[model samples]
Target: MTKKRNMWNILLASPFILAVLTCFIVNFALDRQFSWSLLTAASCLYAYLMLYTLIFGGKHRILFTYLVLAILLIPFLYIIEYTANLYLPQPIYWTTRLGIPVSLAWLAALAVTALLKTLTHANGFLTTGYFILAFYAAERCTNNRIDAFIGPNDSWSLSDHYPILYFSAAALFLLLGLITTAVKRSRSRA
Candidate 1:
């Protein structure tokens, strides 16, 4: 069984290897340089890592996947910036100022997701609440980063950026989860 699983893992990895090879070959053939293929290789590596981690991560799959993402994302973004700067006509430097922070924000969101999953123990309402709250937070963080990058295109208003409805819904869902858990515990005790 272990041998078969290993074989299957190898098979799963084959496509990513093929894609990377193809990208490198095509890139070098067309451009006589290996610039763009770096991006492809980096992307394939990240994808394979995430896939492998998720598949073999067992009960801790979510946490493992999140760790893989958190660890690899910034380096991946760096590769992106390196490739873009090298290949593009003009260098629009945004990696440190925009990409990293936004990625961190999303990572924080994922952390919250993992936390919620653990906390809820598959209670649906809690998961929904956490997801909604994380989504709102990530989106708001992204918009804030963009606003910072662009530098005051228009006058900023709190209402324009914030999703009050989503926040409220998330709060409601959390309340529901708490009530449900309490009632469940009370019944179990009785």
Candidate 2:
């Protein structure tokens, strides 16, 4: 893609970028917090941008900038969880308690992105859903269920064999990506 096109993509995705950053500033500004849906959507956009940059950016400054900013976002998340009196989901909250850096979380996210490879060529919906669900499953398997930002209320413990949930979601993602690729190829052939 041309520089202009890349710029346009980043510009268009700026809302999501802002939303992700808001996790840092939100405590000072708003009484209410962002919903899980909103956070998940922002995360998906961030993941999408990162996936694009990592896979197809190729010396493009614009895409590289996006990727760098996304990496830098880890610090902002850290600041929010550490400095700000904000609520974090149980899975993430445990990380804070365990002193696991957000950079590691980001690295885990990168590994997920790279492993799936669906984010590179799939439609936005497919990619976004995959990213969201994959992370959600990770969160689930870490403790067994998704929880609110404050903490988990359910009995989702750390000892449960929730690996099935995580792996099943991953397999579903691969299946969807394969189906999409097959359809696109068939369309072009026709």
Candidate 3:
């Protein structure tokens, strides 16, 4: 029974492990550069732990509250960062750079929150699936609308390859969601 329980634990954790590994592989393959900030890393680690606990630690209500808090905090944090950037002496371009790390932290929070909620609610597949759809829609909308705000002198072009790239990413997330659902279902049957 102990061994079986261990196996179950491993199975339950596999999706998150796979997601982390895939992120590493993609980062390496794409030669993407990411700054390893301590704050961001800590946020991610805490989020992961909270998510795991929320899913399997029997603290469902507390975890759900944390998830809700995280979701609400993300936009508020962004606004704070934006306000800070405006008052600082740094160039406007630096806002994007500074914001990216904070945004990533928020995104990690969101993902973990979602994962916790989905697991507890037994709606992992639906939550992840809809998240992808929402992401795609937001990406499309942002890409189309952003051009209007940028001046001609701005070096950034809204016509870049982001739309296709984001669409492909959405597809990948959808596939991952499907796989995670299958795993969860199989585990439940065992």
lDDT of 2: 0.56
Q: State TM-scores per candidate.
A: 0.87, 0.37, 0.30
List the RMSD of every prediction in angstroms: 2.4, 10.0, 13.2
Candidate models: Cα lDDT each: 0.87, 0.56, 0.54
Residue 121 C-alpha lDDT in model 1: 88
The deviation in Å at residue 135 for candidate 1 is: 2.6
Q: On TM-score, who's better, 1 or 3?
A: 1
**Which pairs of residues collide in candidate 2?**
88-149
**Per-residue lDDT of 1-190 in model 3, one digit per residue for the tens?**
6698678667766766666666556655665642222224334445555655565556475656566555545544554455455557983543244444444544564565476556656355546555655555544444444443353334443225455665566567667767787888999999
Model 2 misplaced regions, further than 4 Å: 1-103, 110-120, 124-159
Q: What tens digits encode model 2's per-residue C-alpha lDDT throughout 1-190?
A: 5898779778767767676666546633564555333444445565666766765666775548555665656644554444333443442343343324434544466557545554476664456546666575455444422343336665645325465665566567667767887898999999
Best-to-worst lDDT order: 1, 2, 3
What clash pairs does model 3 have?
A: none
Ranking by TM-score: 1, 2, 3
Instruction: Give lDDT: candidate 2, residue 74.
Output: 62
